[model samples]
Target: MSENPHDQPETLEHPEEALHRRAIRSFVMRAGRMTDAQKRGIDHGWPRFGLSLEQGLLDLDQVFGRQAPRTLEIGFGMGHSLLEMAQVAPDQDFIGVEVHRPGVGSLLNGVLNAGIDNLRVFDCDAIEVLNRCIPDGSLDRVLLFFPDPWHKKKHNKRRIVQLGFAEALRQKLKVGGVFHMATDWQPYAEHMLEVMSAAPGYRNLAEGGGFVPRPEERPVTKFERRGERLGHGVWDLKFARSE
Candidate 1:
């Protein structure tokens, strides 16, 4: 019997390849040179606190060596705010993901100097780390602070707060876990609000379904301070997983 075209099953594209095509990274890596201190930080601190995608799905309890509230911060620039948060909240375990080598180095150095054991780091694409390393529904909180706004109108599509990203974050979060995001760009904030508002399995933590006051727990960043001097208003949004 002759084979019919309809009888042949459609060849499916690899899911990871499909994801790679669909995901437009929001940040551009700048040619920022690392200082000697930063280099040393990477060398010395990596063994103690660094993580890799090749680790596969992590057991949060095993990684931290304790059962504590876990907070994952997507981009900890220079490491100061995240370090401060870790210092203040010793009861909580923090996992920071930063692709910028200099920033990662700085954070690692800070972590070593601070002697804080409640924190760890991943120097890779946050999305990949989330997808391949972090176990689903294992997080207590997820933070996205001052992510690349992709401010230009033509580049807004590259912003990371799209519906797909929100859903991915939701999967990593435990039920009732909160995804807190802060942005200095107003349009990007609105974009985040729109996507997160419509995203399933989330409930806006804002009382009336809009921006919320910046919580005290979130330390103000240097970028935020500079934006403040330029009269840029910061928007903070918190959405909790309902299921």
Candidate 2:
């Protein structure tokens, strides 16, 4: 007797394929897990402090007591670099976007512990925040350090250096604003160069074919340390929004 189609187990798609689909959905649909408590805390925990898309363009003068150029750091893993930057540059406002719950919580705890008041965070998709919330040409600098490379050949499309996202970032940054990105994955780094090079209204800031060394303001994060121990090469790419 032939095995019934209904009785046969379905061969699931490859995990990488599934992850890529999920990533695309996460970007397009803006659907990600956040518990009610997390939502409430994100909404009301800092009261007059934290920002969200619903609140609209933040009044920087009112929030920080003086208008300052704003810098955005996407996926600030454990906030090590972000916190360090905030401390180093008190005159510039830093907004960090991260999806990891524990990381966000840890950053918030660190902020309270350090009594740092020049930083704010949003625990959601950076694209969503950039598209619906932040005003155009509002950011002075944008940093993306060591984003997941999706190293597999079949999963390269899942990487964040696509044209659409780069264009979106270009629009969000002010004229002459800097867009800095770093990654340890060479292929992803090359992919980033290709995408950003093709992106309109932006120009590469590097003097040579490669990017400059990491800025002194940024501190190495735990992830970077681990990657360094594992002998992964790191690359940094910087682009400026053109007039």
**Candidate 2, which segments miss by more than 4 Å at Cα?**
1-45
Write candidate 1's Cα lDDT for 193-224 as tens digits.
99889888999999999999989999988888
lDDT of 1: 0.84
For model 2, how does the per-residue alpha-carbon lDDT over 78-171 read when each residue is reduced to its tens digit? 6778888888887889888887765665566667666778888887777667766677778899999888887777556656667667776777
Q: Please provide TM-scores, in order, for all candidate models, with all chains considered together.
A: 0.90, 0.80
Show where candidate 1 strays beyond 4 Å: 1-23
Clashes of each: 0, 0
- Leading candidate by lDDT: 1
The C-alpha RMSD of each candidate to the native structure, in angstroms, is 7.6, 8.7
Candidate 2 accuracy as TM-score: 0.80
C-alpha displacement of 75 in model 1, angstroms? 1.4
Candidate maximizing TM-score = 1
Minimum summed lDDT over a 10-residue window in model 1 is located at 3-12
Lowest summed-lDDT stretch of 10 residues in model 2? 2-11
